[model samples]
Target: MVTDFIELGFAMESGREIPQFSRFEGPVQVITRGPVPAQALADLDRLLARLRGEAGIEINRAAPAATLVNASFNASDVPQNLIAVEFLPRRQMQAVVPNAACFVVPNVSNWSDFVANRRSSAIDWTRVVSRTQAAVFVPSDTTPQEIRDCLHEEIGQALGPLNDLFRLADSVFNDDNFQTTLTGFDMLLLRVWYAPELRSGMSKAEVQARLPTLFNRLNPSGRRPSNVDPGPTPRVWQQAVEQALASDGGLVERRAGATRALSLARAQGWRDNRLALSLMLNARLAPRDQGEAALDALLAAAELYRRAPGGEVHAAHIDMHLAVQALATGQAEMVLDLTARALPAAERSENAAFIASLGFLRAEALSLIGRTNEAERLRVDSFPAARYGFGTEAAARARMDEIARIGTAAQRLARL
Candidate 1:
C-alpha cells in the first residue's frame, strides 16, 4: 500500500486526470514591473536565494523591467526560460482576478498577454509541457507580510505544485493559509519537482511509478508513520466553506454555511486539521450574542489542532483569538499563558504580524498584573515588527491602541 505521504505527493502533483509536470527548463530569470515597494523587492530577492539554496533550483532576480521575448523552449537554450513577475497596484490586479491576493500563470510573459489570453484555453496549465515564460502578479498596496507571503506561495506555484491541498498541514501549498512561509516539506517537494529524473508532461501513472524511489532517495526520513489520508474533499463541503468565508455575505447565511461544513466534517469522521479548521470557521461566524459558544468552539478546535501534526501554527492562531477574549474578561494570567504558548510558534513561522499581535497582548496582560516596566519594554519591542506586519505606522499605532483599549475595558470591569 502506498503511504499517505506518497498519496499526498500525487495529490499535489496532479489535480486533473493526466499529470501535468511543468517547470523552468533552465536557469529562471525573474523580472519585475509596476511601482513595486522597496520591502517587496528585498523580500523577493531573499525568496529567490532561498529557492536556490534550499530547493537546488537555479533562480535569480533579473534587471528591473528586463526585456521579455517570445521564444520556443529548447533544453539546450537557457535564455528562453525567462519568467517575468510584475507587481501591480491592487486595482489593476483585482481587475484581472477579483480580490485575488496574487497568482501565477504559465505561457504568458506580461500583463497584457495575460489579459488577452485570460479567457483562452491556450494559457491552461494542464496543456503546458515545459514552462518557458510565465507571469506572477502581486499587489503592492497590501501589508508587507502579505507581500512576502504572496512571493513565497506564488513563486513556488510558478515553479512547482499547481494545486493547494487542505490536508497538507505543514506547507504554504495548503489553502488553509495557516503556514505563511515555505516549510521543509515544501522545499523537499520542490527538490523532487526539479529532479532530473522527472521531466515535463509525464503521465500520472508514469510519475506515480517514479515517486516511491524518488522520495526514498531524496527524503529518507519520510518513511515514518504518515497521517491517514482523509480522502477527497466533498464538493458540498467545499461550497459550504466558500460560502462561510466569503468576504461579502449575510451573517446569518454565513453562519449557517459554517454550521453545515462543521456537520459535514463530523459526518466524515475527520479528526485532522481540516476538522479543526471547520470548527474555527464556525466559531468566527458565531453570532454576537453567542460569545460563550464561540469561545467553546475555539477551545475545542485548539485542542484538536494541538494533537495534529504540524499544527503549532494553527494552534497559535487560535491562541491569539483566545488571548483577546481572555484580556477582555480580565483573565490576565490566562492571556499571558496563551500568548506565551503562541509567540514561539509565530516567530518560528516568520509571521511578524502574529508576533507583534501576541507581543501587544502579552504587554497588556503584564500590565494588568502590575508589571508596568516589563509591559512598557514589551510594548516598545513590538513596534518594529508591528510596522512591518501592519504595513504603516498609522496601522501599527491603531493596533497598539486597540490592545490598550481592551486592557482598559478589562480594568473597568474588574473594578466593578
Candidate 2:
C-alpha cells in the first residue's frame, strides 16, 4: 500500500522523468468556460464538497468574475490558485488530442495558456515546484456521466496526483477507467497528499522516509502482516496495451497489440486485475465475427474480477459486455440475470452510462418475456439517466431502437 502510494504521488506517467512531488499549497478555486452544462456545474460542486469533507482539501466553486484582455485576445479571467475548466466542443477537443475524453494540466490558468505551453516545460507536471493555477478541458457535447467522470479525474489531478496507476483497482487514478468516481482509496491518497508532512518539490527519498510514519498515523489499520508489491508494470506490456486501446492504431495493429499484451500477461504469471484488463481489452477489440471468442475472453475476465478484492466494479463493467452478448444470443433470462447483478455495482460506483445501458437491456429482457407494462415502466424510469448518459434524446432513442431490434430478431430466430 505504501509502495503504491509513493509511486502514485512521485512517479510521472512518462516513466522516464525524475519524480517531483507537486501539489496545491492553497485553496482551489474553479471557473468554467463555454456552455458548461447544469449537470456539470452541479457535479463540480458536489465534487468540491467531497474534496472538502472526504479528502480535506480546501476548494470552492467560483463563477467567472472578470474579463481579462491578454496580449492576443480577451477571455474570462482565472486568478492565481484558480483552475479554469473550459468545456470545448467535442470536435475541438478531438483536435487537441484525438480520442481524448478530457484532461488537466498544471501551471496554466486557462485554455489559451494550456495550448501555448502544452508542448513546453511550462505544463510539465514533473517540473512544477508548487501549483498556483491549472487548466481542465472537457467536452461540452458529451454525456452527463462523461462530464462528471472528467470533473472527478481532471479536478483530482488539478489538486493531487498527476499519474494514473494500473495496479490500483479501486481508484479513478487507474487507467482502467472502471472506477468513474473517487473511491475511498482515492480520498485517502488525497488526504495524505494534503497532509502537513508533505509539500511540493520533495524528492522520492524524502517522501519515502516520511510515509511510514504518515501512513501509520493516517491509516494505521491498513497495515498488513505481509505486504506484496505487484512490481512495476512492464513497459512492453504497457506499450502493447496503449497500442491496443489507442484510437490512432489500425485494426490489425490494435488486434496484434492486444494479443501481445495477453501473451505478456501470461508470461508474467499475473492472475491479477492487470491480466483481467488485458483479457477485457482483447475481447473488446475482437472482430465482430469472433463473438464466441469475445464471450470467452470476457467470461474469463469476469471470473478473475469476481475473486479479486476491489474487483466488483471491474466485474460489473465486464457484465455490461456479457449482457450485450446475452441480448444478441436471445438469452433474455441471462440478460436479466447479468444486468440485475451488475446494476447495483454500477450505481454504487456512480457510473451513469453503465446504469443507463443496463436499464435499457433489462427492459428489453422483460419485454421478451411478455412483461410489457413492467418493461414500459423500466424504460420510462431509465429515461433521465439515458438522456444524461447517451447525451441526447436521439442517441438514447437510437440505442433503445437497436436493443429492440436485437430482441425482435432473437424472437424471430426462436420462431424459425
Q: What's the TM for model 1?
A: 0.92
Off by over 4 Å in 2: 63-78, 287-293
RMSD of each: 3.3, 2.6
* lDDT (10s digit) by residue, model 1, range 40-63: 878989888889988999988886
Number of the top candidate by lDDT?
Answer: 2
> Any runs in candidate 1 off by more than 4 Å, and if so which?
1-18, 64-79, 225-227
Clashing pairs in 1: none
Q: How many Å off is the CA of 203 in candidate 2?
A: 1.4
| Residue 110 lDDT, candidate 1, scale 0-100 | 70
